[model samples]
Target: MHLFDKEKIYGDRLLAVDDRDRNVTYDQLDSFSGELYRKVGGKKLIFILCENTIESLSGYLGCLKTGIVPLMLDSHIHPSLLNGLIREYHPAFLYIPKTCIEKIEDSEVIWQFGGYCLCERNEKMPPALYCELSLLLTTSGSTGSPKLVRQSSWNIDANGKSIACYLEIDANERPITTLPMNYTYGLSVFNSHVLMGCTLLLTTYGVLEPDFWGFARKKRATSLAGVPYTYQILKRIGFMDMDLPDLKTMTQAGGKMPPRLHKEFALYAKRTNRKLIVMYGQTEATARMGYLPADKTLEKCGSMGIAIPGGRFWLENEQGNEIIEPDIPGELVYQGKNVTLGYACCKDDLIKQDEWKGVLHTGDIASRDSEGYYYITGRKKRFIKVSGSRVNLDEVERLLKEQYEGIDFACVGTDDNLTIFMDQLILDGGEEIIEYLYQVTGIGNRTAAVKCVDQIPKNESGKTLYKELETTADNRIQSK
Candidate 1:
C-alpha cells in the first residue's frame, strides 16, 4: 500500500486540523489535494521548502495524491546548502513558502504556494503508487555531510501500521507532535494518525513554554512523542507538573535516554497515568523497529523492548552469523517491510534496496536477555576495546547523566582514548563524571585514559558520531 492509499481508504474523514489558523476539514484537504494533483501531475521530483505549518502539511499530503516524489528541504537551511541539495536531488520543479521565495533566483520555476509566487505549472506529475518513493530525507548532515535516503511508499505504510499496532492506537486516540517537519520522528506522527483516522494536534511552536501545556490539556492528547533531547528539556522544565490526563502513551526515541532519567520518567509517567514507550529506530528503518512495553518499564532498565509487528530481529556476530544465545553482544539486524530502500553515500547517487544476506544491519550493538527482552549495549561505533575488555561509552554516558546535574552528554573514544562530550559550562561536571567512570570501570588499567571536553559532536537525531568526533580532533590538531 502507498501513502495515497491510506487517504483513499480514509477519504472524507478528518485528515488534519489547523486550529492555529482555521480548521481544515477532510473535504477541504481532498479539494486542495485534488487541485494540486491536477496541477503537478508529471514531475519526477517536487521540492517542498515550507515551514511546519498548515500549508507545508497540505503540500506534503498533496504530494501523496500526486505520486510526485516529495523532496523536503528545511526552510532554515543555509542557501548554499539548499542550492547544493537542489542540484543533487535535481527536482524538476520547486515549491517554496512565500517567505522564502527571494532566496532562489535560478530555479526553472519557483511556484510559490502558501503565499509564494507561482513559478511554474508546466511539469506533469505521475500517478503510479506501488513503485514510487514517497519522500526523500537526509541524515542530519551535522555528522559531516548529509546522505540521501529514499523511503518507498510501502515503507511508509508499513511504518505507520507497525507503530499503530504496537502503540495500540484506536480511532479515539489523539497524538500530539512537536517534532520538526523534516525529521522522521515528526513524519511518523503525521503518517500514523492519518492512517488510523486519529486526530493529531500540533502545538510545537513554543514548546517548553507554559502555554504548550495549556494546549496539551485542552487537546486531551492521548499520545505524545519526543527525542532524548526533547525529554531532557521536558524533565528539566518538570513534565510531571503538567499532569496531563487522557494521555495513554508517550514514546521516546532518536537517542537513548539516560538510565536515571529513563527510570524517573517511567515512574513519573506511571504516577500521571501515561505509558512511557521507550522505542528504538533510525530513519533507515522507516521510524521504529523495537519498543518496550509499558508494564515492563523499569523492570528492564536499559532495554529497548522487542521488535514491532510485521518485523523480526536477531543479533549477529562480527562474521554476520546470527547468534541465538542471550546476552551476547552483536550487530542488530532488522527484517521487515519498514526497512528503507538503501541509502545514498552522496547526494548524486541512489543506493538500491538490498538486505545484507536478508536483514538490514542496524549499526547498533544489542543483546537479548534470557526472557527474550532486548537491551542495547552500545552503538557499534561506541565500543572501544582496550586490552580485550570492551568499553561501552553509552554506559559511561548513562553514568554521567545520573551523576552530573542538568547536563546531557556523549562519550566518544578513539586511538585508545575516551572523551566526554558536555556543554561548555559543564566541564567541571564532566571531570567529576570521568573520575566516577574510572572508579567504576578502572579505565586507568585499560590501554588509555579518559578525557573531558566542552562539546561532543552529534547527528540530527542526537546520535553520537564517534567516527566524526575522532576525525574532528585529528583535523583540528593537524591544522594547528
Candidate 2:
C-alpha cells in the first residue's frame, strides 16, 4: 500500500487546520483526492504552485495518492521564470492559485475550489517518467532554477518515517507551518506530520507577524519548525517571553544556526521543558539525514547530532579514506534509503533511473566528536544559504555578468548575508543591480549587498581570488 493511503490514517482525525479556522478530516481529504484524480485523468506529471492552504495541501496529497509526480514551486514565483519552466518541462497539468490563471497561456481551467484552479495544458504529451519518480523539487529554493531533485516514493517514505520516529510524532500533535511548503525542510515537516495524522496548522504569516503567534496560541499548536533565519526573528521578537504552554517541540534545520543563537534556544528549551531538535539535511537526501536528540541539546550546542533512524553518516578526507579520529574535518557522506534518485534538468532526464543508489556525498565539510555527534565546519561547494535557501555563488556571478555586460562580478559571504563585488563603473547602478538580484535570487536587500571594487582580484591563472574577497567582505561586515 502507498505510504499515504487513507487506511493508514487514524479514523476521523482532523488532517489540517488553517488560520481562517477551516479544517478537514482524513475522509474529507480522501474524497477531494478522488475528485482530483478524476480531473487529472492519465496525466503523470503536474506543476503545483504551493501555498499553506487547504486547497494546496489537498492537491499535493491527491497527487501522491494517485501516483502523479508533483513539482511544488513557490506560489509567488516570478512569471518569466515560471513560464520558462513551463516551456522546459511541459507539465501536463497545473494546480495554481486562481489569480495566476491569467499568467498561464494556452491552458484551460478544469476545476476550481478554495481560491485555486486546476488547469489542463492545451498542448501536452506526458513525458515518459521513471516508474519510481514520485516528486521533483527545486534545488535552489525560490531561485527559479529548472534543475530539480528527483525523489522516489521510497525516498519520501523512508525520510518521513525516520523523522516521525526520531521526533516521536503522534496523532495528537499539531505542527504550525513557518516555512514555504516548496522548500525541502518544510515539505518534510508537512509529509511527516501527515504520516502520523497530526493536525497541521497552516498559515502564510511568518514568525515576525503577530497573527502567526495568535493563530498558534489559539489552535494550541504542539510544535513549530523553522530555519536559522526564522529562529533569528523569533529571538529578536523575544520568543522566550512568549507564553506558549502547548508548544512542546521545536525543530531547527535548513542551515546551521549561529553558535550563540543555538545556545540561547537550547537554554530556553531546557528551562521550559520542551524539546529542541537541531537537524541537518539536504534536498538530495529527501529531507532529514541527522537530528540531535533533544536531551543532548545543551550538552552539544554546536553539533548537528547523529544520523536519523535508517541513516548513517561518516567523514571522508580528500583521499576518499574515512576519518576515524574525532574532530577531524572532512566531507560528510551519508548512506540511507532517503538518498534521492538523482537530479533532473529537463523532461528527458525524468526517465532516468537511480544514479545515486543509496549513498550521497553531501559536499559539506564536517567533523565528529568522540560521542559521535557531528559538527559542520565548512562547505566544499561554492554555495551559501541565504534565509535557508541555497544560493550558488557561481550562478549568481554568471547571472549578473550576463545581465550587465562588461561588468566583473565576484560574490562572497557567509550564511544569510551575500556580498557582490562588481566593477566600479556600475556604482551608479547599484540600486537597480540589487533589485535585479532580488528578482532573480529571491534574496532581498536585507540579506544581499553590492560593493563596487576597482577590479575583481585575479591571479596569473585568471581565477578570481575568492579567499581574498572573502577576507575583504569579512572586514566590511566587522566595520559595520
Candidate 3:
C-alpha cells in the first residue's frame, strides 16, 4: 500500500510537529501535498535537497502520490557535490531551498514552494526508470560517490510494516526526529510512523543542544531514536538524571554499541518501566533486519536479537554454505522482502531490475546463539594480518572498551603497526592498556602505539570515519 493512502482515514489527526513547534494535521498535509503534486507531477526523476521541515516532507510525500521517483539527499550537501550529482544523474527536476537555488542558477525555475524552488532541466532526460523503482538514497558517506541504493515500493512498504509491528506504533505515539531523513534508519522512522498515523516531532537540534530535549518534552514525545553516537552524547550529558516521564521507548542502531552502554541503558529502561530497543540493518535491506526485544535486554545483552517480522537471518561460511552450528562466527546473511532492487552507479542503472533477489550478504562477522539470536562481532573488511596472525581491528577496539569504561578508541592497522587513537589523553593506565594489547595479541609492543586527540571523527549517525583514520595513519607512517 502507498504511504499516503492512510491519510484519507486519519484526515484530522495530527501528522507531525515541525521544528518551530507548529502542528500539521493529516488534512493539511494532504491538501498541501495535493498542491505540490500538481506543480511537479509526471517528472521522471526529482532530486530533493531535504531537511526535516514539513515543506520538504510534504513535497516528498506528494512525489510518492504522483508516482514521481525522488532522490532524497542531505540539504547540507556541498554545492560542488550537488552539481556533480546533477551532472551524473541528469534528474529532470530539483526541489531545493531558495538559498541553494543560486548554486544551480543555470537551471530554469519551474515552481516555487515558499522557502524552496523547483528547478527543471531543459536538456534530454536520463534513461527510462524501472517500473517498480520508487526512491534513490545515497550510501552513508560524504565521499561524493555517485553510488545510490535503489529501493522499490515493496521494499518501503514491507520495512515500514515490519517496524510498526514490532514497535507497536499507533496514532498516539509521537516519535522525535533524532537523525537526518536522508539516512535509512532516520527515514524509516518517518515512514513507519506516518503509515500508522503516528505523530512525528521534527528538529535539527542534536543531543548536546538544550533545545532538543526541550522540544521533545514540550511535544510529549513517546519515542526517541538514536545512533550509538547519539547515545554516547546522551550518556555524557547525564541522560539518566533527566526527568523524561513521558518518554516510553528509546531505540538505537547505526553501529554496535559497547556492551557496557547497552547494559546501562537496559537497566535504566527496566527500572523506569520503559523500553530500550536495539535494532540492526543496512541501507541495502531498506533500514531494518533485526530488533532485540526490550524485555530480553538483560538476557540478550549484546545480541542483535532475532530477525524482524517477515525477515530471516543466517550465517554463511567462506564457501557460501550455511553455518548450522550455533555460537560459531561467520558472515551474517539476511533474507527478506525489504531487500532493495540493487545499487545504482549512474542514471542508466536505474532501469535494471532486482539483482539481489530476496537475499543480502551483510558483510558483517557475527555468531548466532543456540536460541537463534545474532551478535555482530566485527566486519569482514576491518581486519589486518599482524605478525602472521589475522586480527580484527574492531576486536581490539572492543577489548580497549572493556578495559577502559568511558574512553572512545579507534584502531587502525598500518603496514608495520596497529595504532589506537583515543579521544582524550588518559593520565592513568594508557600505557598499561597498550601493554595489555601487546600481551594478549602477542604483537610486539613496539609495533603498537596510542595517540590522543580532542575527539574522534564521526558522521551524523555516529559511525566512525575509518577512511579518515586510515588517511591519518598513512600520513603518520609516511612522515616517520
Candidate 4:
C-alpha cells in the first residue's frame, strides 16, 4: 500500500506529466527517486523546500522510501520563517532549490537533482525523530508557523486509500496540480494519485492562470481538486462554460464554499454529467475526513456530507459529552487511521507519541441532520480561510503590530474576506498594511480589506470581541 509501489506493476505507464508535456513514466520516477534516495535518504530529518516540479516529487518519494522524515515546506517561504524553522528543528539536511541555497550557509551540497540541491547540515545533531513519524506539516497555512501536524506513514496510506475509494480514482485518471505542493490538500492529491498509478499533471501555474487551463486541456485531465477559494476563481473565470470535455470529477475542501456557489457548481456538474464533491478536512486529520457524494449535492447543498469510507464522525458538547440528537451544534469529532499523531511546536515535540490516539477533536462547530449529514456552522478556532489558506487572526494581529507599531488592529473575516479593523487609521497606509497582511498570511489583497474604526470592540477582560467584529463584517458585506 505504499504510495509509489504501483510503479512495480505499471512501470512503462505515464505517472506524471509536467507543463511542458514531458511525461514521466513510473519507471522513470522509480529510477529518479532511487538516485535521490541514495543521495539524501540517510538523513534522520530533512527539510524539503518543495514546488510542483518533477524533482520535488522525486525528492519526496525518495525521502519516504528511505525512511527519512521530511518536513515539506513551500519553496518560496520567507527567509525569516525558513531561518526560524531551521533554528527550531535543526534538520540533518536541507533539500532546497539551487537558487535558494545561498540563504542557507555553513552547509555542504551533497547532491543535485536538476535545479534542486540536497545539502547536509553542518554541526547537525542527530534528530530525535520518533519511529512512527514520517512527515511534519504546518497546521496553519504557509504562514511559517512553528506549529506542525505530526503524521505517520500509516496515516498517509490510510487517508490516501480512503480518498481513492470515495473519489473513484484509478489508473486512467489524470489530476492536474491546482494548489501548492506544501499544502495538505495538494499533497493528498499527490498521494492518492500515486497510490492508484494515476497520471498526475504537475504545473506551477495557478487556477486563474490561462496557462493552467491550456495545460489541462492539452493533457485531457480527468479530475481536479481545489479549496473553496479555487472554486471562487473557477466561478470568476466562467469555468462551467469552459470546454473541459475530459473533466469528470471535481473536488472541493479546505473550507466551506458558499452555498450559492456550491449549488451553482452542483447544477453545472449535473448538466455536464460530472461530479462535484465537497469534502471536509484539516491538516490534523492528514487532509480528509468527510466528503459529500455527488448524488446528495443538491439534496444536501451546504452539508459537509458523511464521513469518508473507513472514517467516522460524531459530535461532542462543550463538556465532552457525545451529541447524538440532530440539529444540535457541537464540535466535530473524527476517528480514523488518518488522524495524526499530535502537534509539534518545537523539535522536542517530534518524539511525542500518538497523543491524538486515532481521535481528532476538530475545532469546528457543526450540526448533523436526521440523515447523518454534517454541516459546518462555524469554527471554534480563531482561524479564517482566505483564498483556501488558514490565516490565524491572532497571529495576523501580532504580526501586524510588529510590522506597524502603535496601530491597534483586530483581524476578522467573513468566509470570503479578511477585514482589518484598526483603531487608529494611518493616513494613506491602508494598502500598505493590506500588502503586509497578504505577505504574512499568503492571503491575496482581493480578499483583504481595511476599515477605519473609532475603537475595536473588546470585552472587559481585554479580549477583542470577535463576535462584534463579525457583525461589523457582515454589515459591511451586506452594504457592498
Candidate 5:
C-alpha cells in the first residue's frame, strides 16, 4: 500500500507540474527519489524545508520510501525559529533549497538537484526514532514550538485511502495546491492524490493572484483544496463567477468555515453542478477524521458531518461517560487507525511508543444531531466565566464577524475580563463593540474591554495567534 510503489503508479503518467511548466512523470519521480535516498547514507532523521516544488516533493517521497523520518517545515520560516528546531531535534540531514544552505553553520552540501541540496550536519548525532515513526508535523499554530505530532506509516496509508475514497479521486484528478505543504490539511491532499496516481498542480502563487487561476485553467485542474481563510479570499475575489469547466470538486478543511460562507459555497456548487466537500481534521489525526458528503453540504451547513470511512466519532461528558443523547455538547472523540501515535516534545520523546492507542480526545465540544451529523459547538478550553456566567470566546468572535461583515475581530480574556482586539482603523467603534458584547454575553461594561491593535496576529496558516493576544492581555492587566 506504499504510495510510491512502482506497481501502483502509472509509470508514464505525470506525477506533478510546477509553475515553471516543468512536468515530472511517475517513473522519473521514483528515479530521482532513489538518488536522494542513496545520498542519505542510512541517516534516520532529516528536516525538509518544503515548498510546492518537484525537488521538495521528491525528497519527501524518498524519505518515506526508505524509512527515513522527516520533519516537514515551511521553507520560509524565520532563521531563529529554524535554528531552534535544528538544535532541538538534531536532524542528521537537511534537505533544503540551495539559497538556504548558507543559513546553516555546520552543514556541508553532499548532493544537489533542481535548485535544492542535501546538507549533512557535521557535528550532529541523529536521534533514535520509534520503529513505526513515519513523519513529524508541527501543530498549525506552533511552528516555533518543539512539540510535533508523531505519525506512523499506517496512519498515512489509512488516512490517504479514506480521503481518496470519500473524494473519489483517481488518476484523472488534478488538484492545484492552495496551502503550504507543512500544514496537515495540505499534506493530506498531497498524500491522497499521490496515492491515487493523480497529477498534482503545484504552485506558490496564492488564490488572490491572477496567475494562480491562469495556471489552473491552462492545466485543466479538476479539483481544488483550500483552508477557511483561502475560501474567504476566494469569495472576495469572485470565485463563484470564475469559469473553469474542468473543476468538479472543491474541498475545505483546516478550521470551521463561517456558516454564511459555508452555505454560499454549497449553493454555488449546487448551481454550477459541482461538489463542495467540507472536512474536519487535526495534526493528531494525521489529516482527516470526518467529511460532510457533498450531496448533504447544504443540508448540514454548519456540521462537520460523520466520521470518515473506517473511523468512529462519539461524545463524552465530564464524567467520561459516552453521551448517547443527541444535541448535547460534549468532548468530541475519534477512533481510527489514522489517529497518530502521540506528540514529541524533544529528541528523546521520538523513541516513545504509541501512547494514545487508537483513540484521540479532540478538545472540541460538539453535538450530534438525531441524524448523526456532528457540529462543533465550541472548544472546551475556549470558555471563560464572566461574573460567574460562562461565555464562549469562539461564539463571541463568530457573533461579531457575522454582524460586522468586513471587520476582523478576535476575542481573548480571563474569567472576568474579555478583551476584543480589532484593527486600529476601527478604534472609534470600540465602544459600540463593547456594548454589543454586553448585549449578547450579558457581561458588565467594566468586565469587557476592547483593544485596538495595528492588526490581529496570525500564523502562516491564517489561524489567529491567541497566545500572543493572551500575553498582551496579561501585560495590559499588569500595567493597570
Candidate 6:
C-alpha cells in the first residue's frame, strides 16, 4: 500500500513523532505532508541533505505520496561526493532544511526547509506521481562507486508490515530513530511506525552518554531499535543497570551482534522479562528479512534468526545446491515482496537474479539450527562487520588506492577488528586515519579498530589471497 493511504487510515489517531521539535500528531503530519506535496508540484526527484528532523519526515512522505521520487543522500556526506550524487541523480527539485538551502544551487523546485511552498504545478512540468515510487540510496560497494539500490512502495510497505507483525509494534509503541533516515533500517523504522500509526522518537544523536537512556525512559519508550554497535553502547553503560518499565522490546539489525553481547542482552531480558529480537536485512529488501522471536532470543543466540512473515529463506551449499541438513552452512537467499525492483542494472544491468519472481541472493553465509533459526557463520567474500556496520574490504582499498601512488591494497575483518594492509608506503597517520574514518562512516559508534599490515597478499590475477590473510589475522589476534 502507498504511504498516503496510511495517513488517511490513521486519521486523527496518535502518530506522535518526537523529532527536532517536541512532538507532532497525525493531523499535523498529514496536513504538513499535503502542503509539501502541493509545493513539490506533486512529483519528481528531490534530494534531502537536512539534519534528522520532523521536516525531513514530512518531506520524505510528502514526496512519496504525491507521486515524487525522493533521492536521499547522507546529510553529513563529503562536499565532493554530495555534488557528484546530485549531478548523477539530476533531481528536478531539492528539499532540505531551510538552513541548508543557501548552500545548494540550481534547482527548478526548491522548497524552503521549515515553511511549506505550495505553488500550483504546471501540467507541462514532470508528473509528481508515478505508478512505481522508488528511492536511490547509496550502498558502499567494493568498486569504489556508490551504487544506488532502488526500492518501491509495495516492497517497503510489505517489509514494514512484516517487521511490525514480528516485533508487534502498535499505537502504544514508540521506536527511537537513531540511524540516518537515508538508510533502509532507519527508513523501515519510520515506515513501520507510520503504517501502524505508532510513535517514533527521531534523533541522530545516539545513546553514547548515560543521559540518553534517561531521556528514552522519560519518553516512556515502548521499544528501541539499534544496530550491533548500539547494543554495545547499551552493554557498556550497563545493559542491566537501567530499568525501563515501559520498554517492552528492543531490536538489533543491520549487521550481526557478537555472540558474547547477544548472550548478555538475553540475560538482561531474562531478568527484566522483556523481549530482545535479533534481526537481519539489507537495503535491497527495504530493511528486515529475518528476525529471532523475543522469547527465543537466547535459545537462538548468534543467529540472524528466521525470515519474517510473507518471506521465504533457505541456504545452499558451496556447490550451489540446497543444504538438506539442519546444521549445514549455506548462502542465505530471501524471497519476499519487500525485495527491490532491481539494481540500476548497468544502470540497467544493476538488478540481478529472479527475473520472474521476488528473490534476493544474499552473499553472506549462514546455517540453520534444529529449531529453524538461522545463524550467520561469516561472509563469502572479504567483507567485514565492524561494530555492526557492513564495511566492504574492497571499498576501503579503493579509497586508499585513489590516495596512494599505486593501486594495490587489501583488507580483512577479524571477529571484532578490521585490518587494512596497504603497500606500507600509504600507511601514515595511523591514529589520525582512525579518527578520519569516523567521519567517513557515519555509523553510531567507534566502530572499527584499525591496524597496519606489512604486505597485502594477492594472486597473479590480483585476487586477494584469503587463506594467507586469515592466517595473519589469527596471528595478530593471538599476539594481542
Each model's RMSD to truth, in Å?
Answer: 4.2, 9.9, 2.3, 9.6, 2.4, 10.2
All candidates: TM-score: 0.87, 0.82, 0.95, 0.81, 0.96, 0.75
Judging by lDDT, tell me the better candidate of 3 and 4: 3
For TM-score, candidate 1 versus 5, the one ahead is 5
Measured by lDDT, the strongest candidate is: 5
Per-residue accuracy of model 5 over 1-480 as CA lDDT, tens digit each: 376654234887988999999988888876876787788876488999999998888788778877889999988887888889999989988999997876676888888888898898874466898999989999754458999999999999999999999999888999999888888888899899989888999998988899999999999999998877788888999998999989999998877888999999999999999999999999999999999999999999989999999999999999999999999999999999999999998999999999999999999999999999999878899998988888889888889888787667788888997878765455344667767766876776777777766667777667888878655432131111
Q: Runs in model 5 with CA error above 4 Å? A: 6-9, 140-142, 427-429, 470-480
Q: In model 2, which range of ten residues has the least summed lDDT?
A: 471-480
List, in order, the clash count of every candidate structure. 10, 0, 0, 0, 0, 12
Pairs of colliding residues, candidate 3: none
Q: Kindly report which residue pairs in candidate 5 clash with one another.
A: none
Ranking by TM-score: 5, 3, 1, 2, 4, 6
Which model scores highest in TM-score?
Answer: 5
lDDT of 2 by residue, 1-480 (tens): 245764344667888999998988888877888899888885378999999999998888888777888999988888888988988888889999997877787888999978899999975556888988888998866657789999998998999999999999988899999878788888899889888888899998888889999999999999998876677678879999999989999999977766667888999998899999999999999999999999998899878999999999999998999999998988999999999999999989999999999999999988899999999865678779988987777668767766875466888888998888875544244678778888887888888777766667653113466766644442132112
Q: Write the per-residue lDDT of candidate 3 for residues 22-70, one digit (tens) a residue.
A: 6778898778766766766564888888888777877777776667889
What root-mean-square deviation over C-alphas does model 4 reach?
9.6
Residue pairs of candidate 4 with colliding backbone atoms: none
lDDT of each: 0.69, 0.85, 0.85, 0.82, 0.86, 0.66
Query: In candidate 4, how many Å is residue 72 off?
Result: 1.0
Residues 302-387 of candidate 1 have per-residue lDDT tens digits of 78999988889999999989999998989998898888777664434442544332257888888899988888877787778655
Which scores better on TM-score, 3 or 5? 5
Off by over 4 Å in 1: 1-13, 108-112, 115-130, 141-146, 345-358, 385-389, 424-431, 445-460, 464-480
